[model samples]
Target chain A: MYDAGKIISGIIIFFILVSFPIWISAASGTIGDVPELNLPADEEQCVEDAEWMRANHMDLLIDWRETVVREGVRVYTASDGKEYNMSLTDTCLDCHSPKAEFCDQCHDYVAAVPNCWSCHVDPGGS
Target chain B: MNALYAFFAVALLMLVAFFGVWGLGWNTLFAVMIPYAALAIFIIGLIYRVVKWARAPVPFHIPTTCGQQKSLPWIKSDRIESPSSTMGVVARMAMEILLFRSLFRNDKVQLEDKKRVTFQGNRVLWLGGLVFHWSLLIILFRHSRLFMQPVPDFMIFVRDIDGILQGLIPAVFITDIAILMALTYLFLRRVVFPQVRYISLPSDYFALFLLLGVVILGVLVKTAWKVDIEGVKVLAMGMFTFNPVVPEGIGPAFYIHIFLASVLLAYFPFSKLMHGPGIFLSPTRNLINNSRAVRHINPWDYPVKVHTYEEWEDEFREAIRGVGLPLEKE
Candidate 1:
């Protein structure tokens, strides 16, 4: 009797705004499927474990870049005593050569625009 | 004092962020997991709080009236102040929310040297509240750039207007300075005003200190430290997409800034900061002053046994006759 219609409509609007993420995801047709990453076929093993790499690869890459570019420390000794050059172009691309297949797969899926390609030349790109 | 404890709590939070990221090397946990968890908790907690409030039934017309109500056609009604219609109520709420109308009318009472009490308008609190809220809104709107890809034109327009003073190397946002100044004023008001200080709780100070810490860290990141802006954007996008990645070259300072913000989000529903949404649910502000126009009945009112006047007269008929009191039944 006391404008229950207004209150009901207000509640409806509130729910719509609150559940926006769910509805947006539903509309976009990307609710549950995780981004499919393309693994390198040539290498059987990486410098680190798959789980560790998935989480901390960006951090490790940053450390490598800072050490190599700023401090002029090129040689990186892995925990397993494997010595590797701290060069993204030479070392990383040597294994994961095709940037589109390897990097862009996940990046595009997530809409993450990393600045790495801005300065560094993609080995896969013409 | 409670304020001291609150200050320490915020300090401890900052230390946790610093140590968690730098010392423990929990970059991924702080960067990805904590943000996701905080956001989930915030959404769930907010929904729960709002739903609980909505379910609550206000059985009475308890709108706080500050002016004349709607009456005889000749009598004028203060529609904006004592609203009696839906449109009037909307206008009232708009003024309250947008301009802080009630706060603007706040009065402070103080005893003068000659034992005379004087009431004066306290505009400082109103100004601080207005500035702080507006700046916070602007800052949040600007942050949309981090979450959205090819950020919306309107958000870009807001950013441009906020950073209109563009002579500096990194153009300074007006909201950045305004929020800090307003927060400081609010903090000092609690300290300097004896009446406010007496009523202040640890939670009150905690909210202010936490907000201050967040704003200060944000200012530091924007001005002092040069962080990877693109990397931060990448991280924001990842969080939204449920494919979180700790971006490269994002410095420890950025981690601390975000960690503090995450804490604020997680603490929001439980704290007085919930006033943002709670204000809308408030019966005193949102209800219309239409008690005279319409009779309000409590929906949950239950039937109760009652002794009617006839029944009372039947029971006390002899006593009433002795006292020479006439009854309707007799």
Candidate 2:
């Protein structure tokens, strides 16, 4: 009975939880790309390939110890190439520049405080 | 006392940080120094966590596999859910990372007669998270026009798409609603769910509140109180090129918004919010499940003298003969 009740409650929450994605997909389906149907099998690169990636993408490597950080979760690759970890960079700033007409107009329209300009930047620095 | 004291201290700091913008006239620090500090904290904290995890020894090939392992050809295997090969693992990771597939699979229990398994999608959290992220991205895109020497076309395209509604005064953008709803949902979920609430801390609420405060203040500065946007562009351009100087005719609310944003950035890496990057480093999600077919030798693995089967058999050959067991050779 208890398990059953838990299931019911879980189901309700699940539906509520699902509503967000469904709604988002329905609304903003046009933006971004997600390859869901035809997925690859191997997630990790072979040892040789990993080595090649390291050699080619040296800029990706940084000193973890001296680097600034945020959370309890860890992602570190050893200098010896024995350990490899990856995390997505925070790409929030690239779009929200203060000089851009797109951000200022709309952010202004809604009477919102725009923070895109605080740091030093040009309007379009391609 | 430590916990209570921490909460009040945080409250005090937030208040001070806010007042420094409104009252203390510390515009330079509010606009610049604080953001750098937060960014530093985020980077340092993130590295600290990752290094710590990297140091934890995982000798075994333990991946939370859901598909078929590479085994005897006669046996059928589930490939996508439980990946035995590297390609399968990649696909699995793609699904897990890009789409919250695992969270999507989360089942809710139902009770009436028999135990019911309702197949309602459980991706709302993921979607809200996505909305917040994507909307934030677009907002950033729109902002690029202000700082760039020559505005990018893509920025213009994205801005048009976001502000497609352009219905009322100043052209209403979609991000306003998206961010608002996303933030509300995340915040409400924390308060509503007992399980989530149990783990909820003041910092979590503070992050949401702080973001909300920035958004609100932004709206105020933009529509409610229009500021010199050209001046803002000059100020921002100067900041990016490392030649920051106060722009003339910029409003105080702009400073407030800038200060709060700086706070968000600096606070980003140290808070639980840093999970944005931590997900990729997760061993459970990233590690391949090829243990049965392949040996995963640890780089830090120490040397061990292992006895071979033939060596053991060599010693037991005489004993086997005594027991009348067939010998391969003789």
Give the Cα error of residue A61 in candidate 2, in Å: 51
Task: Name the runs in model 2 displaced over 4 angstroms.
Answer: A1-126, B1-14, B40-58, B70-80, B84-87, B108-122, B168-171, B303-330
Q: List candidate 1 segments past 4 Å from native.
A: A1-126, B107-121, B304-307, B311-326
Interface RMSD of each: 7.1, 19.5
Q: Locate the minimum summed-lDDT window of 10 residues in model 2 chain B.
A: B1-10
TM-scores of all predicted structures: 0.72, 0.59
Candidate 1 chain B: minimum summed lDDT over ten consecutive residues — where? Answer: B163-172
Chain A TM-score relative to the true structure, per candidate: 0.84, 0.23
Model 1 fnat value: 0.00
Q: Each candidate: RMSD to true structure? A: 9.3, 22.8
lDDT per residue as tens, model 1, A1-126: 244565567667866765554565556665444445567777877777655565456667877988998999999998889999998889887887678877775555434345588899877767
lDDT of 1 by residue, B1-330 (tens): 989999999999999989998898899999988888898888778767776776667778789998898887789999979997989889999999999999988876779899998866477889999999999989987776666544446777788788876423233689999999999999998998999999999999999999999999898876666465545665666676777767665567888899999999999988788898778777888878988778877767788999989889999999998899987867
Label model 1 with its docking quality class: incorrect
Give the lDDT of residue B65 in candidate 1.
93
